[model samples]
Target: MDIFTGLINGFDIALSGTNILFCFLGAVIGTAIGVLPGLGPAATIALLLPITYIIGSPVTAVIMMAGIFYGAMYGGSTTSILLNLPGEAASVVTCIDGYQMAKKGRAGAALGIAAIGSFVAGTVAVLGLTFFAPPLAEFALDFGPPEYFALTTLGLLLAVALSGGSIVKGLIVLVSGLLFAMVGLDPISGKIRFTFGSIGLQGGFDFVTMAMGVFGLGEILYNLESAMKTEIVTTKLGKVFPTLKDWSDSKWPIIRGSVIGFFIGIIPGGGAVISSLASYAIERKYSRHPEEFGNGAIQGVAGPESANNAASSSSFIPLLTLGIPGNAAIAMIFAALMIQGITPGPFLVAEHPDVFWGVIASMYIGNVMLLILNLPMVGLWVQMLRVPYGILAPVIVLFTTVGVYSTQNQVFDVYSMLFFAALGYGMRKLDFDPAPLPLAFVLGPLLERSLRQSLLISGGDLTIFVTRPISGTLIAVLVLLIVGQTVFFLKGRARA
Candidate 1:
């Protein structure tokens, strides 16, 4: 079907009472969670995964999940403006100018412009997703085992390169995750690989449990080591609307940010944080008064806020079109679809049109809901910051435990979650990133299967990956990424 017809059908599904209600709920819940520092969209989605099962339809569940992803992004700027706290990692840059604006009694304007900018960027991203994703999916229909293997290889490499850490560390974590994923059984032979005489190991590790442990409980544990405090700006929030001058100054930055964020988000490991940082740097460089950046510049807030939200929305493209999630949050969303027995891939648009279009349509509705909700309910979001971490941490732990136990009424699942939680905590202490591990774990099976299948197709000839046009191009890209990262890593070390 054409884009227009597909969107029309999607609206038909998204406009239903159930889908709309869940979308709104997701947005509200996501915004609330985002107001709490360190609880990013990925952790929020992981914490809420079990609840998706109760939502009934796969499309409905996904509509809600998608709402949570981008909705958190919309609300993340709140704490940044009010308390100079980044509720989401992507909101970190917003703190520089947003908090300064708040101190100068321009908090309301900073937040209002952020909401407006986010809405505009989100709309742009949705339009891109509507038109761009389907054609990309159609193109992916040509992929075979060799192509898939090469693509996944490139994806894994890109994940490491963009991890914002040492490439060697990212690879270490990724390989560890692959080993973890090898437990249970070999896919082709159906022979148990590492069960070690335990029935609980028979099903392999549950993605939901692992995700909740690492992102939900582990994050809370990591944060507990640091003192959590909030000194909220109590200045009477001025008019909750940007002045004409604010809009005039911010218009171009928002547009530029939207375009930049959309493309960056399509790359593996590229998401809100990176997009926001890049947008801020770009805006600062282009600004007539570059020196005004860290003070009360409205462009600083508008640009990064818009970019992060735009990136969040466009990050869905790779997952829907290529069955590849670019980051941890998208990976969890992929897991959510798998829980519903709906696989995401190039054929997803053709096979599960309702899910694809329903999610896209819900984004339009969710953005409107966020804009309306954020401006009017800024006070409520601020109140969320007042809840003590002492009270919040245990509640998060309890909820994670309950969710894991409810999965199959099995104690083993809970134990596995606790195990990963401890492991996740240790990894954090060692300055290692836990993001790539779960993502690698999730992608390991697909990578292995593709590798095995490609070998069989080529009669054990490993050259098949570099022989095909698409596959060869992908492998070449992977090699370039490795070389580039190695050179960069060496240069930094030499300078150090």
Candidate 2:
């Protein structure tokens, strides 16, 4: 009952005119980026972070950013279905069946299922957030430095565990990300480690610049190198609304995906991407026509789309409740929240119920807004597929350059972005995954800070890490994962 009352009050606050306008703006911008290839939510949010300073209210800024994050999730599928391009990693699964469905003239069905599934998942996940976030925040408040370190270690290991191929390559990329993160100022000594004597290097790599170079410019370069092109197949405007039969097929996948994705997302790792892939794998295994996978399987689109949205919603649990961002997008939101003089944690819910619950309530509203926005606009998004890369490539580069330059108003950052763009292109050509690198970059500084803090608290005694049950258990699990992977690889090599 208290939760119900709180949620109602949140609705009142979120629906206010100013906040509502920001929500609309965020959705519109996010959808625009999602429909376009290359640019993603992380880059968009990072580019917009500086603008939050002008907005002057942390709650409003964070709310708007949240709207963009989820809105991009809604929008990313549009390109996947219409152009065979995934605007974001979470939408990659959408391309397998989504693009195929388009080729088979089932574009309407794929788009409809994606939007409906996302709507259902986003709504349910918000309910999960409203109820679960406060309690988790409370639990996190009790964590010490050692516990935090252990949790981060588990997260990194899970990242390695979930890496699709070549654990060695994943670890290498993860280490590279950590090294790149270390290029900034030293957290403890305030000493510069990798500045290379350049004043510009003092600030280290900007997240926005790195993401834009790797995702946006890198994608453009890759597409340019390939002669392959995307054609928008004519889609018969069948029922935009999903049928009962569609519901029957998708119901269990949605529920299962929501449950699976929500929990994975709360774990403070690559939860969104992991959940999407996991949902697709599960749906494929349980599907009546498993062979239909990668060939416009409705279950393929339904399960992953739901899982990704649910994961996106649940990833907020850690950020809003514990001030620990699970990913880059959430990290940007954290920066926005901090600028508002609000420290997100268990006490935040009690201290600022309006902020917390208002954001929660707005998610519900945002989901509805996205569904309404996506349905009537399906034809328009499909039209976007027709945009020629010859024209689009230069526009992407322009946005990338402008967005990176806007971060610090420095030409140096733009140069760094172009450098990363070339690096990203090289890595993609080498079959290296860029995903793990960003996770490592994001987590590296936190890992260093936590380690140092734990040492200080324990008087430099490493035993403190193992003395705590939860932390110790997590460390042990990481070790087991590492060893398990090694053993599996050895066996495979021996068999070969």
RMSD of each: 1.1, 3.1
Please, what are the lDDT tens digits per residue for candidate 1 over residues 64-176? 88989998888899988888888888899999999999999999999999999999999999999999999999999999999998988788778878878877789998998
Q: Candidate 2, after superposition: displacement of residue 81 in Å? A: 3.8
TM-scores, all models, native as reference: 0.98, 0.87
What are the clashing pairs of model 2? none
What tens digits encode model 2's per-residue C-alpha lDDT throughout 91-112? 9989999888778777778889
Give the range where candidate 2 is weakest over 10 consecutive residues by summed lDDT. 228-237
Model 2 stretches astray by more than 4 angstroms: 1-6, 82-87, 95-106, 227-229, 288-297, 335-355
| lDDT of model 2 at position 58 | 69
Q: For model 2, what is the C-alpha lDDT against the true structure?
A: 0.80
Among all candidates shown, the one with the greatest lDDT: 1
Candidate 1's C-alpha lDDT? 0.90
